[model samples]
Target: MVEAQHKKELERQLWNIANTLRGNMSADEFRDYILGFIFYKYLSERMEQYADDLLKPDNLTYRQLTTDQQTILDDIKQESVDYLGYFLLPNELFEVLAEKGKNGEFILDDLGEVLRHIEQSTMGSASEDDFNGLFSDIDLTSNRLGKNPNERNQIISKVFEHLNEIQFLLDDTEIDVLGDAYEYLIGQFASGAGKKAGEFYTPPMVSKLLAKLVTAGKTRLRDVYDPTCGSGSLLLRVAKEVGVDNVGYFYGQEKNPSTYNLARMNMILHGVHYRSFDIQQDDTLERPAHSAKRMEAVVANPPFSANWSAAEQFKTDDRFSDYGKLAPSSKADFAFVQHMLSHLADDGTMAVVLPHGVLFRGAAEGHIRRYLLETKNWLDAVIGLPTNIFYGTSIPTCVLVFKKQRPQADNVLFIDASQHFTKASNQNYLQDDDVERIFNAYTARQNHDKYAYVASLNEIADNDYNLNIPRYVDTFEEEEQIDLNAVASQIQQLDKDMIDIDKTIADFCAELNIKAPF
Candidate 1:
């Protein structure tokens, strides 16, 4: 419990550091720089700690080692590069740079070069792809920091001072204090970043739900994937549900370069080795990064109703070729589903968050929905979520669970969890109980009057394959009968009381020698 409190305090302090750059630029711009700096700090601290542990027997710290001892330094560099996937010199450590900045030494240049060296250290190594361009978003010369270089240096130094004071405890043996705090800071940025947040951040509760759904009844997953990975929070959440060691590998793709970088940092910060995760930058639908292998569990919270080319050439693509119709160019909700579906292993369970329209929308989407329900019989469940649960949009959304193989292929489960959420600020969120109830009902595959229902394939066919939640779960409430006679009698008595009160007021006004006020 004390650790829990300390974690919260750490998260608070990390978020406070953002204030130093809050007004210098837009939230999106500042978020990139702040998060990049935090990533750098994490990397630096890890490097120094690892090197110190290796040098302990010699009664020498990495910081105190002499420059002439090239042989020892070279051995340490090889080991660090092999184990940590990067190398950092003692002079390039985070504490060294923070002290330099505190002493009013211009560090904007050295800081930039240090970040570059961290990335360059991984060259000719397996982690090169993972660490390459990781720090590309941090531009020290951006005029937005200030009108001149000194102003920019001063503000950056202030930020470094703020971050240097915190003890991240980068250890993962016990509670993941720094990792959870990192997640909290990312959420804070996502919430304030507006629509852009949707591009990279899925609300934690929502990610938790998706993670639980996909990982249910599984002790280990050979591989987990997210096509529109964003900040890779959803992918990490899945690892949390399944033990990290139990998860074989993490795979994801992001279209935004900056968000792609964040995903890599998030993975490393969570203590996932560079070899354990493969995060690529590119549009998943157009150029899938991980198309060759089928994932053991697939989860994604894709952009709602996002536009895509939907060109004729895509019909021949393997991911979409199986589906008879391409999703309309205007809305690619089902397109993403098809892309993920194509990569889902036959034994895997897939869950995705999509807007409600996919449930009943006709035309091309209807054709794709019909294929999944009727022809393939892969549609396992449809769970409706509350509105305003996402960062940007307030539209009602639902989770679609699918499986290539199912024990009970004759029916589909439906859960209406829209009303079972707590109101907080401007958003509504599901409590832990709410999520468990949904997961339990899904696992039980039982009928719940107003919460869950198991519908036969025929029943779904009767409704023309519309997986809308309301069609299965009946949440309609009946209003009480009105007492018109009692109400009318009360009104009559109130009329007499009004007359008495008016007469009393008139008498008082007359006694005061003033006309009675109506």
Candidate 2:
């Protein structure tokens, strides 16, 4: 519990640091600088540790090695690059740069060169792709840093100094102290980012539901994936549900370059090694990054009501081919659904967060919804979430669970959790009990009052395959019985009082030489 408290304090401190530098800049803009600084600090600490271990047996400190010790230093660089995937010269380490900027002179140019060298050093190595462009977002020379190089260097060095003072304690415990803090900071930024937050983050509570739903009966996951993996948080949450050593691979794609870099960093920060996860940068909908593989558990909270090309060329594309017509170009909810379903393994289960429109919208969406229920029979359950539960959007969303093969093959579970959330000042949240009840309803596959229902395929067909929540869950509240006789008596009394008031008004108006007021 002490460790947990320490972690929470660390998270709070990091968030305070984030707000300190945020100034008046946009959350997205300031996020890159702060997170980049944190990553730099992480790399620097790891490098220092590596150097300390290497020099311990040699009776010479890595920091004390002379510039003339070229052969020995070169060997150390070769080995460190192989192990850490990037190299930082003793002079180029973050603290050294910070100290230079603080006491000596402007160091923006040197720092930029050092960051470039870190990326360049990985060339011709297995980790090249991973390290390349990792620091691309940290533009030290940008006007946003400051008007002049000196001012820029001052702020950058101050940030570095502040970060250096923190006891990251990465090695103090197996749990990722710094990584958890990073996630907390991400959550903080997401809260303020509003609609833009949806681009790169899935709220932690929503992530929990998806993770739990996908790993329900499993002891170990062979693999887990999120085609639209923002920061890789949702994918990582799956491991918490089960011992994840057996999770053989992690697969995901992000459309934004910055988020792609963050996902990779997030994976490494959580002690997920470079080789175990394959995160690519590209549009997942158009490109379908992992076409060659099918994952055991897939989860995604794609952008709600996002638009897509739905290019005619994709008519032949296997993901949407079976559905006959592509989801309309305007609404891409089902397009993401179709993409995730295609990548699902035969024995795997997939849970995705989608806008409620996908439930009852007409035209192509209705057709696609019909096909899923009537043709492929892939959808297993639809769970409605409370409104304003997502980071930005206020419209209610739902989780749609699909399986290549399902334990309950004949019926689809529908849960109306929209009214079950606790209302907060800014947003509605699902409490612990709320989450458990929803999970219990799903796992038990049992019916409940005003909360859950199981609908047969025939019943769904009778409704023309409209899987809307109301048709199944019946959230309609009955009206209270009205007392007509009491209402009539009250109305008669009111009429008599009105007549008496009119007579008095006429007498007053006649005396005052004015017409009676109506």
Candidate 3:
């Protein structure tokens, strides 16, 4: 309970800072600035801690080191670069900037320079790709912050001053205070971002469900990959399912440059080393970043029904060539599925969240579904989810789980969990119980009345390859039969009582010496 309270307090503080920086910008616009500042502060704290640890043996503090000591400074710089993948001078640290801002000093120029130096420090290093252009979205000189330079500086200074008051608890070894707070801020931003939220964030419960589904029966994974990585939350959730050292590597690709930077920052803030993750900014389908690599576990919550270049040339691409048809240019649902399948290892399992239309949509989608079921036999399970659970759309969604090597290739498990969800103010959410029930049903792989079903390949073929949940899972509740006899008897008694009362009224009229009109 105390931990929960601390988390809530931290989240409240961070969100308050975000509001202070919101100014006149949209949630999406201000989101970039707030998260970027938080990330910068996190990096500063981490660097200070690491430097202090290294300097403890010398009985000299990192902040007190004189630049005139060329030998010692050079040695510390080399070690920091090798270990931390970047070097920050004492003056460039976040605390120094915050203090300068608090002291009514001009910090815009120095802040911009420090950010640039951070990027330049990784030049020609093994970690260059991970840190390159990571801060490109932070436009310090943009007029959007204010009408003029001074106004902009003042706004930024206020934000820095507010953030300086919150303690990130970086010294705590047991709890991931800053990481949790970062996730909370991301979620808070996503909640207000509307439809654009789908581009960079996945609902936390959905991420958890997918992580649990893919990591079933395994304590460790060779690696995990997400083609549409977003902010890398899904990838990090997969890491949390097992021991931190168990997962070998993390790989992902995002098309949006700004979101790609967020993903890299998210990974680093979660304490993942630079060499352990390979995140790239590019179109995953067209120019596949990790084309040659196969992952043991693959998960994605890609944009629903997104448009893509389904040119004639793509028909020959390896990812789609085997399907005998390219996913329609108008809808790229199956296109993402095929790409993930191609990158799946021989013993891998993949789970993806897609629109319900993918199940029963005819023409190209039907053809792809048939191929996956009849030819490849990779379709393993289909779980239906409630509508309005996502930040943007209210349409009901489903999770499609596929495995390259299945023990029961002749059958597919279908779960209708669409009815089991808690309603929030504006969105539906899957509680811990909801997620567990789905996972348990998935593991059992047996029929449950009005909840789950195991359909044979023959059954799916008979239905013309429509894998819609209602067809397999029978959730129709039989209406209660009306007792006509009892109702009629009660009506007769009521009629007799009314007649008696009328007679009594006539008797009373006669007693009162009044003539009855009847």
Distance (Å) between predicted and true CA of 11, model 1? Answer: 0.9
Deviation in Å, model 3, residue 477 alpha carbon: 0.8
Q: lDDT per residue, candidate 2, 352-455, as tens digits?
A: 99998999999999999998988899999999999999887899899999997887789999999999988989899988888898999999988898999999
> Worst ten-residue run, lDDT, model 2?
167-176
lDDT of 1 by residue, 216-306 (tens): 8898999999999998999989999987778999999999999999999999988889989999999888888887989999999999999
Count clashing pairs, candidate 1: 0
Per-prediction backbone clash count: 0, 0, 0
* Predicted structure 1: lDDT: 0.91
Q: What is the per-residue lDDT of model 3 for residues 1-518, given as tens digits with 9 covering 90 to 100?
A: 76777878888988998898887877888888989888888878777777888999989877887778778777877887788888888888888999898888889999989988888988998888988998888988888898888888888899999888876744664236677788888898899889999999999999999999999999999999999999999999998887556899999999999899999999988888898999999999888999899999999999999999998998888999888988899899999999999999999999999999999999988999999999999999999999999998999999999999999898999999999999979999999999999999999999999999999999999999998899999989989998999999999999999899889989999999998666
TM-score of 1: 0.95
Candidate 3: regions farther than 4 A off = 172-175, 496-518
TM-scores across all candidates?
A: 0.95, 0.90, 0.95
Let me know the TM-score candidate 3 reaches against the reference structure: 0.95
Ten residues in sequence with the least summed lDDT for candidate 1:
167-176
